[model samples]
Structures are given as structure tokens and as C-alpha cells.
Target: MRTPHVERGATPVNVAGTGGHARRSTVTTHERIDVLLSLPGRSPEVTIDDTDVSERKHPHDEEKGAAKLQQEQSFEESSEETTYVEFEEGDPSNPANFSYARKWAITLAVSFFSLIAASSSAAYALGFPSMTRDLNATQFEATLGLSMWALALALVPLWSTSFSEEFGRQPVYIVSGVGSVLMHLMVALAQNIQTVIIGRFLGGAFGSTAAAMVGGTIADIWAPSERGLPMSVFAIMIMAGPGLGCVASGWIEQNPHLHWRWIQWIHVIFYGIFLVTFPLVMRETRPGVLLKRTAKKLRKKTGNMHYRARVEDQIPSLATLMYISCTRAIYLLLTEPVVAAFSVWAGFAWGILFVLVESIGPAFRSVHNFSTGEVGSVFASMIAGCIVGEFIQIYQEKLYAKYYPTKGPEARLFSACLAAVLFPAGMFIYAWCTFPSVPWIGMAMGIFVIMTSLFNIYVAVFTYLADCYGVFASSALAGQSLSRNLMGAIFPLFSEQMFSKLTYHWGNTLFACIATLMIPIPFALYWKGPAIRARSKFASQVIHK
Candidate 1:
């Protein structure tokens, strides 16, 4: 009888010659066979089967057979098992692996949405006179619109981010974009102060989706190493939006024919354009959501219920997820020292910015007798400072790259230490320089310096938090956002009174002293952050990994 042929490294077919019990031998290149016999509970045995083998087989034949067996087994196993799709390292479908041009296009689109959202909050400030006059509202009541807008910006992100995490960023963007447009129309056509305030509050609530999600989207698309420049551009859009809106809204409010309603109308026009284009241009970038969708499609086509994305297993019910995400920022804020410290600094700085926005008109009007349009022009200094800060950030990026291995995530704070000092210095300069005798340029320069310092603080806090938290970065940043926006809402309400009572010089000095007290924060983080992180369970897991 012809000897039964056995392919190398395969689940060998049984041969009849081994008594009534069947035995199969799979051959390897070293002329060893792994034999499995019919004996119950017996382990596989490695042995040489040279005595029964034919002499015609060459050494190379065994190797070729082994390779073929491996290929066939791989194919069979792949067919039998349900395989989920994922982005391989260089996958084009992966947002991180997208072409540079495509990535930037997405960044710009998301950033523009952020700009619109942020700009809307401050744009209402410039129209205070018109709004007050038309509605017969008190100045304090008019300012409540700004407060409401900011409060909504702070509060809505808690739940909106949860929705984005559950549903995907694209759906959230579309719904929010449409909601913003409708709310702007509601404000534009409103006949009463109540309607206007309600519309503005709702507008801000919807608009904040862009502000809250854009950072997460950026994190999705870029590695921590490559994030600096894109993040700088995003920072510029964020910081510049309020300043730019103040300038534009001042002009709009000053125009005899346009008046305040046009402010809302103009925003509607801008948002209308966004609503049209965003759906066309923005694709879903979240990997987990994308993978889940792909798994759904594959299961549908193949009729395989076993096919599942890893994220599918972890997804909680919407109500539960929302509850967790909504409370997570508060929990992190209370528990994490790094998060709490940075949030305080960033929140204080952000409050100061909004205070400047609210107070600039009165501050300049009292000293220089500048017109409303011209008071708005002073924000240009802040914009210019942000541009300078952007360049400085480029330098910081190089420094971070050089020192990141040794310094860890704290390398991101190199510029922040300088910024901390500059913050108080600029406030001191602004306080002492607002006199008529001091040229307008001096006050402008002080504002410029303050804005530049704020820019650095903003970038450092965000990048550092992201680097430290990894997957939890979104929740960490949400804590910072809540504090910053809450402070922004509260600060402006009291700023007018503070400046009225203490005047610009002493009021600013008080702000300066507070900033000076906090100057040690960045230095502390730089020297002691790693030790602090090592001690914490959450941070230690991230640090060691």
C-alpha cells in the first residue's frame, strides 16, 4: 500500500497502519513530526518518522510544504472567525494617518466652527446699548445676556460631550449647527428682552458643541508629538474670535441703519454658510464610532452576529453614559491636583480676558474719550499679541521636542513659566499706564502683553492635560472649560462695578496681585509634576505606560 502522504505542519490525516487506533504525524523542516494519536487525554508528542517516509522528498520540499500548510491554516481560521476591522498603523482610513492636507482641512473647518461659537458670546457685548435702548432694559439686565450665554456655554458641554462620545461627532455638529442657526434667527426677530436673552442662551448652548468637541477631534487626528502647530492655530482661532467679533460688532452697532438686530442677523448669515458647508466637508473622525459602524455593516452583509467592534462591548446606555460624563469633570476637578491647579490658573486667566472685553469700552472712554468703535479697536492689540504668542509657541514646540524624553509632559510648560511672570507684569503696566499723559500705545502694549501671556497659558494647560491624561483628556479639559466659562460668566457681571468703585488703576492692580500669587504654579508643576503623578493611581497608570 502507498504510504499516506502527510503535509508538513498541518493537522495531518490519519493513517490506517497504526493498529485500530489512528495516528497522524505532521512533519517539520528538522524532520520532526508532531503526532496526535486517538488515545484519550494524551498530549501531542514530537518524534522523527523517518523510518516510514519515502527517500524521494528533498530538504527544500519540506520547507515549501510547511509554508503552504501555514498559509492554508491561516486562511481557514480567518474564514471561520469573525474579524473586526481596524486601522492598521498606516491606514488611510485612520484620521491620524490621513494626508497632511486633509487633516488641516478638517482642523480649519472645526476651528472655524469654534470661532463662530466663541465669537457669538462676546459679540453680544458690543450691542449692549442698542439692546438696552430697544427693549428698555437696564445695563445690568442687558449684561445678563452675556452672562446667560456664558453660563450655557459652560453647562451644555457637560451633556453635549456625552452625546458626541455616544453618537459620534458628526451628528452632534450637525444638530448643534442647525440649532445655532435657528436660535440666531430667534434672537434676530425677537421683540422683547426675555426672548433675546433666551435665544442667546440657547444659541450658546448649541454652539458650545463646536468648542467642546474640536479639541477631542484634534486629539483624534494628531499624535501628541505633532499636535503643537495645529493646536496653536486652533488656539489662535479660539482667542482671536472674541477680539475679532468685538471689532466687527462695534462697527455693526455703530452703524445707524444696521443697529443691534443686525448683529444676530449677521451671525445667522455666517452660521447659515457653515450649516451648508459643514455637512459636506466634515467626515466622522472618531475611531471607535467608525469601527462600530464598520462592524455593523460587516455583520449585516455576512449575517454574522459574532462580528463586533471592541467599543461595542464597552458602550453603556445613553442615560448612564450621560450621567457619568456630566459628573466626571466635577469629580476630576475635586480629586486631581494637576487638573485642579491648571483649571484655577486657566479659569482666572480666562476671566481676566472676558473682564477686559467687558471693561475695555468704559476703561478707554473714561481715560481717552474714545468712541465705541474705537474702544473696540483696542482689542486689536490683544489679537496682535496672540499672533506673537503663536510664534513663541512654535519655539516652545521645538523645546518640547528636544526635552520631552527627559522632562516628560512637563516639557510643554517651558513657555508657561515665562507667561506666569508676564501676566502680572502686564497687569501692573496696564494699571499704572492708563493715565491721559501715558500714550495710548502704552496701554495697548500692556493689553498686548497680557494677551500674549494668556495665549501661552491656554496652550500649555490644554497640551499638558492632553499629554497626561491620554484617553481621559476630554474629561480633564471639560473640567478646565467649566471653570473658565463659569469664571468668565461671573467676572464680567462684577467687573463694571469693580472698575466703577476702584477705577482701572487699582482694580487692575488687584488683578495683578492675584496673578502674581499664582506665578509659582507652573514652576511647581515643572519640578514636582512627575512625583505627584507617580503617587496618583490614574496618573501613574498613564505615566508608566
Candidate 2:
């Protein structure tokens, strides 16, 4: 018998003749067919409508040729139920099938959403002095705007992650992205500092959605092995936004045409654009959501009422989803040791970054007598560092592929270890070089080192978590964000006092010492990570699944 080639998109149907010869439809999943009919000539065309999911049989002999098809169908259904439930091959709704241009469009839109939210917090730092005078607020009170933004960034992702899981990612992205834009406008129009803080808080609350879901969206499209380059790009955008905001805010504050309020205006305009573009380009990439939609469409077309794609196919009720949004994040944070360790390390780095941002301007102005714009230029050093870190990441990606082809998630830690050492090296350089006589270039070099390390470590950690946790990557990243953002929010509250009491030298030195102490963590994880993961209940379940 000649074997037939299966064509694309055609569901296989088996045609059985009276002589036991059977022809299979090119696209059908059925293995064989039995026929008792004596119908002569060429095989008749039989169309199976959507209603008949089970194999059809003649009334006289219903028992023949039925068992095999039923068994195959049951096995297929069981597989679909157990799997994460991705779209069928060539499904247009799947982000992986999106046109190249569309994928980039979605990526850029999401990046901008991240940019506006992250920039708002750091941009406000530049205008704190003006805000203090205009709003009749103390420096501390004006600082609350930044702190509030950070606090919201920390808190909101916990809830937003759950919503994204239930309602689908596109809805969360649009609603939150637009909500942030509206709050930015309110901040721009605020009558007092109190109003501005409230607006910023609300804005940050929504803005945090981009931070949490963007990676998950990317993951939905790109397989784990192919994700590193895009992950690097997104990581750069995430870190660069804050520093870029500082630079932009410096120029905005110095210009006679704009003031503190314009900072909020800029955020509003930026995010407003993302809000508009997101719905058009950003596709839902969540595996569960995509499968649910596919199943729905299939059910409608086929009229098969018994079709359920998976046990979790039911759309999560609003109340259940909300509860998940509120509770699971805290559960992950408290229970996951991997989360706890990374969160502490990331939080420390973030605290140091914000502290540097808050104090570096004063240090430069007092020591080098640079104008605000000139001081803002100092952030350029960090941009340079970010670029260098990207190169290092590229090289490390190659190294991992070649040397440790199957080294598991810990292989990603090589770059992270380098980052840990680089972090303190930068801190030490900057800590001791804050004197008036030192050239401004020295300070810039120190900052360059600090930022390069930060970016490298960030990408390494991000990739490692995504690789190790697999499906739980979102929650794990959210756990880290909560701790890191909290530190970013709170560290600046006492930064001024630390600078005053200990002097810039000792103050930054303390940070350097702490960073240096963490240098061993990645190395230890590199050696013992598999065992650590084995002991984790969540990690075990995720790995097995």
C-alpha cells in the first residue's frame, strides 16, 4: 500500500470500503478505518460535521472500527488537558506566528510603557527642590512623590500578575497603561504636592503592569533558548529608563519653558502613545488564554458540547481572580527561597542605584561646580556601562552554549558572578573618588562601572529565573520586583542623613561593602543550585510539569 502525504490544515478522515481498503484524510489524526458497505466505484466523499467528535459507525455493526479511533481521541484529549495548551499550528492569534513587524511593534510599545513609568519616578527626583519651594513642602515631603511611586511599583505587580493570568494580558496592558497616562495628567495638573503624590502613586500602580507582564509576553512568543537577545534588550530598557529620566528632567527643570509640572506632562504624552498603540499591535500571548480562545472557536465551529481543552478551561471568575491577584504574590515571596535570595540582592543593588541618583548630583555640583545639565550628563557614563554590559552578555551567551550545553540554569550565573564583583568595584571607585579635587571624569568612570555591573547582573538573573522556574517565572520576577522597588522607595528617605552623617565617602563605602559581601551568592548557587531546586516544592512541581 502506498503511504499518503498529509497536507497542512486538513483534518484526517478515514474512508473504509467493502474490501477493507481504507484511505485516510491527509489531516486526520485517525490511524485506520473498517468498512462493511458494498458501495461500488470510487470512494464516496463523507463530510463529518462538528457534532460528531467520536467515530461514526454503521447501525448494523456499531462495535466494529470504533475502539481504535476512540482510544486515539481519548489519548489526544488527555494530552491537551495536561499540557499548557498552546494554539494549533499556524494559528494567527499566537504571538509566535505574528509578523516580524508586528512582534517588534508590540515590543516597542511595551518598552515605552515601561519607560514612562520608570522615568516618572526618577524624573521627579530632579525637580524635588523646585517642588519643595512651589508646593510648600519640605525636602522630605517632596521626596514622597518618588517614594510613593516606588511603593506603588512594588505593590501593584502582585495584583496585576493575577489579573494577567485570568483576564488575559492584553486587557491588563491596555487598562493599566491608559490608567497610568491619566494619572500622569492628573499629576501635571495637581494643585498641591499631596495631589501630585497621590497621582504618582496611582500612576505607578498601573505602570507596574508593564514591568511584570512584558517578560511573560515575550516568553509566550520566544522559546527559552531563543529569548536571551530580546531579554537583553528589554533589560536595558528597564534599567535605562530611570537614568534617562534623570537626564531629561535635568534639562526640563533648567529650561525656562518648562518646570516640574512638565515632567508629568512628558510622562503623560509618552505613555499616552503606548496606550494607543498597544491594543492594535500587542497580541495575547498567555498560553492558557490563547488555548482557551482556540478551544472556544473550535467548539463553536464543531458544535461539540463535550469539548473542554483542559481542567482549567473555565474562565476564572472575577472574584477568584482578584483573590489570586492579592494573595499568591505574597505566598510566593514568603515561600520561595530562590525568590528571597535574589530579592535581597536585587533590593540592595536598587537601593544603591537610587541613592547614587539622589546624591550624585549634589556631589558633582559641590565638588566640580557643574551646572545641573552638566551633572545630568554624568548619567551618560551609565549608558556606556549598559552598552559594555550588553557586549559581555553576548559573549557569555556564546560561552554558555559552547562550554556548558547542558549545565542547567546555573550556567547563567557565570555572568552574574562577574556582575557581583563588578558592582562593588564600581562602588569602591566611586566611594573614594568624591573629593573636590578629583576630576569629574573619575566620577564618571566610577558610575560607568556601577551601571555596567548592574545591567549585567540584572540580565543574568532575569534569564536564570526564567530558565529555572519555567512557568513560575512571572511570579518569581514579581517577588523580586516587590523587594527591589521597596528598597528603591525607602533608601532615599534616609539618603540625605547618611550622606551628612558619614560623608559621601563613608556612606557609599557602606554600600560597597554590602555589595562585596554578596559576591559569593551566585558562585554558591552555581555549585548547589540543582539541590536547592530539588528541595523546593514549587520548583519541583514546575519542573515535573
Candidate 3:
């Protein structure tokens, strides 16, 4: 019988480490026949299915194999020696291999970061009355301060992602956080509206990273199958953070000793603390970067001049990667039907949120005679709504695990349909009950309902897109973010005008009607989505390994 030759790239095992399974060494291969017999703890001389394989082959073939092996050995001896090392399986250094507790810690930290960023954008909205008076600006001008911040939030991240890819994630995150801290100081110390506006824009530009990259950070540590709960929590924090800011800013502005500027100063102090702490905990998570580092280490250890990974192996140049990222986002927005529909709906919802941010203080203070703090307290309803949405998400996750494991993305749409109903209903309640005779709690309840619906709709849409497009998620999310933030920035400009032309009740009624009209959209997608994805050019064609 011929002696089986080991294949190149096959490695010997250290059986103890693997609990008795022989570990393969790297940089060697074995022929198919040799490998089957090489498995340890098996009878080496045995035949498969008790077949007499030993009697089937010619006995004289061994001598010929030895001659060939000797020739190959001589050739190998003359060639340069190369030492090969095996890569660790799911390396501990890899972020994906981080313990669940550690991963959650990172998630929570990023969630807090997201909260502060979003909150700062809207926190000033409730204090616009004080801002207009102190800065000697018109109501329209005061509102522009809030609008510009949100606009910066929308546009600046397209550039920030480029920076993150260039300098590394932690550097970008820390620097951005610090930038916001400085901008906050400027806002607090501003002598004119332009200075404060510049501060707001710069603050928003820096803070935008939290909004843009938090999702990317989450994606790094969590696999798709396990991402639901952590993602929901993060998404909820992003939505609720801004509302919390409104609450605090309202209270601060109401104080006779404290003014609108204090709100900025206070946020600056809080964010400065986070900025200090961020570097200690935030670690590198990008796979390409990590893999490149691994390759470099191997080259150092082995002292082999020929050891090199592909050019595509390392993180690509920032300009090239950013262009790809932004271009794809645009392509997705232009081409994907699902993205288009969801973006528009999400945009409208976001516009409504900002409109409320701009208008709600005036409505409550003028109509109900509440102080700034009391008006801000009214935003607590939105927070309550977010909590309710989270519970709903938990329930949806349960349904996903138990009933629709194979089709969980479809199940995820449950929240979207729920939002469709609740959003419109809240609008109606808030609109018709605009009178002072109506209890203020009624208004709070209406805001709560709308917030809950918005949360459901936003999260459902976000989760759905991420699920549908695996590697393409960053780009897809960028598209949605662009639409939603643009709408947020634009909506506030027309809000005062809209309210002037229509009574408050009718204006809110119009919002309710629009929300009600969108309720059917998620349901239609839930049922028909598979078909749509099947026909999609970019959707079904791309497959993740």
C-alpha cells in the first residue's frame, strides 16, 4: 500500500488545549486520505465500515512513494525555510470575543454618550424665550439656534465618519466629545447670538459622532442573531436623551438666578466628565484594523520577509472609504424602495418631534401659564413613552425568539404597525384638547402617546434595515439619519408659520391625519417584504459570509 503524504498547511495538535481534540498546527496541509486516519484516539489500522481496504491495494507501492518523498525532501532542504503560525480561533483580542458583561458595559457607555449628544441638540429649545430676551433676538432668530444645531447634527457626521476611520474610533469619539465641551463653554459665555449659534453648530458637529457611530460600535461587539435587546436599548437611549435634556434645561431656565446659558455650561461640565473617562474604556473594535495588527505581529515574531497580508487587508485610506460610505448611502436612498418609504415616514416623525420641541414650550406656557421648568416637566411624558416603547420591544423580542426565529425581521415590524395607530391617536388627543379647560395632564398624555409611537416606528425601521442589509448596515443607517435629521431641521422653520395659519387644534389635527395615513405602511411591508426583497437588486443579491 502507498504511504499517505501529509498535505501542506496542516499542523500538529496540542490536544490538551482543546480538551482532547488534536489541534491542527498552521502552515501545513495533508492529503484527504492522510487526514481521515490522523484523527487521534481512533484505531489507526482500522478499515471504514469494516471493509478490507488493506487487501484491495498493491503491497509494492510503498517503495515508489518513499522515492518520491525523498526527492521532495531534497528540494525543500535547498529552499528557504519558512515558519508558520496558526491564528487563534475567535481571538480573545477580537472585540467579538469580549465577554458579554464587558460588551454590555461598552454598550451602556456609548448609550450615555448618545444621550448627551442628542439632548444637547434639543435642550436649548425650551429656553428659547430666555434666549430671545437676553440676546435681543426675534422669536424666529431664537428658533434658528435650535434648527441650526439639528442641521449640524444631520450634515456633519458624513465628515465625522471619515475622521473616525482615519484616526481610529476612540480618538474620534474622545476628540468629538471634547469639542462639544469647548463649544458648550462658548455658548455659555456668548455675548451675541452669532457666537452662541457658532457654538451650537460646533457643539452639534462634534456630538454628531455619538449619533453616527454608536450603532457601528454596537455592531462591532454583537452578532446579528444576538443584537436585538442591546440595540433596542441603545436606540431607546438615543431617542430619550434629547427629551431628558429638555426637561433639565426647562427647569434651569425657569430659575431666576439661572439662565439659558447655564444649560450649556451644565452640559459642558457633564460631557467633560465623559470625555475624560471615554479613553480608559473605549477599545479598538474594527476587524480590518485588528486583523492588520495581527498580521504585523506575526511578521515581527516569525522574522519572515515575505510575510504580508493583502493591501485590502488593512483599513483602507480615509478618503476612499468615506467616499464609498457616503456614495453608497446616497445610492441606497435613491434606489431602495423600503429605504425610501421608511426614510420618509421616519423623517416625518422626526420633523414632528422637533416641531414639538420648538412649539410645545410656547403652547404650555402661553396656554396653561406654566413656568419654563413646568413646561420642561411636560416632556417627561415623552420619556414615559420611551419606557413604554422599550417594554413593547422586549415583548416583541420574546415573540421573535419563540415563534419566528427563522423570520424574526418580519416579527420586528409589530412595533411599526403599533406606532402607526398610537401616533395618530396621540395627535388627535393633543389637537382637540388644546384649550386651557383641558387638564395639562391630558396634553402630557398626548405627548407620551406620540413619543411611544415614534419610538416604536423608529426602532422597528432601524432594526429592519440593519437586519435586511448585513454588511451594508452603516450605509443604510446613514441614509435614514440624513433624511430624518434634514426633516428635523426643516420642520421647525415652518412650525410657527403653520400654527399662525391654522389654529393649534387644526394644526395638530393635520399632524395626526398624516401619522394615521402611515399606519398601514409597516403592515403592508411585513406581509409583502419577502417578495420585495426577492426582487431587489441590492438586497437579495449581496450575501454575507
**Candidate 1 per-residue lDDT over residues 468-521, each given as its tens digit:** 887677788888889988988889889888988998999999999999999999
Instruction: Provide the clashing-pair count of each candidate structure.
Output: 0, 5, 12
Provide the lDDT at 216 for model 3: 78
Worst 10 residues of 3 by lDDT: 15-24
For each candidate, the alpha-carbon lDDT, in order, equals 0.79, 0.73, 0.75
Query: Against the hidden true structure, what lDDT does model 1 obtain?
Result: 0.79
Best by TM-score: 1
lDDT per residue, candidate 3, 1-545, as tens digits? Answer: 11112236544433222111112223222211223222123223222231333344655655555556566665543232222222245556667777888788788888888888878888888778788899898888777878888898778776568765555577778888888889989988988898888888888888888888887788888886777777887887888987899999998998878879888888888898787777767787664455445445655764543232222223456676777777888789889888888888999999999999999988887778998889889988889999998999888777766755656467768778888889899999988878999988888889999999998888887878877776676777788888888999899998999988996789999999998888878888888877777787767864523
Candidate 1 has which clashing residue pairs, if any? none
Instruction: Name the candidate that leads on lDDT.
Output: 1
TM-score of each: 0.83, 0.81, 0.82
Which stretches of model 2 miss by more than 4 angstroms?
1-86, 294-318, 321-328, 541-545
Residue pairs in clash, model 2 = 10-27, 11-27, 11-28, 12-27, 12-28
Per-candidate alpha-carbon RMSD to the true structure: 11.7, 9.9, 9.6
Name model 3 segments beyond 4 Å from true: 1-87, 297-311, 403-408, 542-545
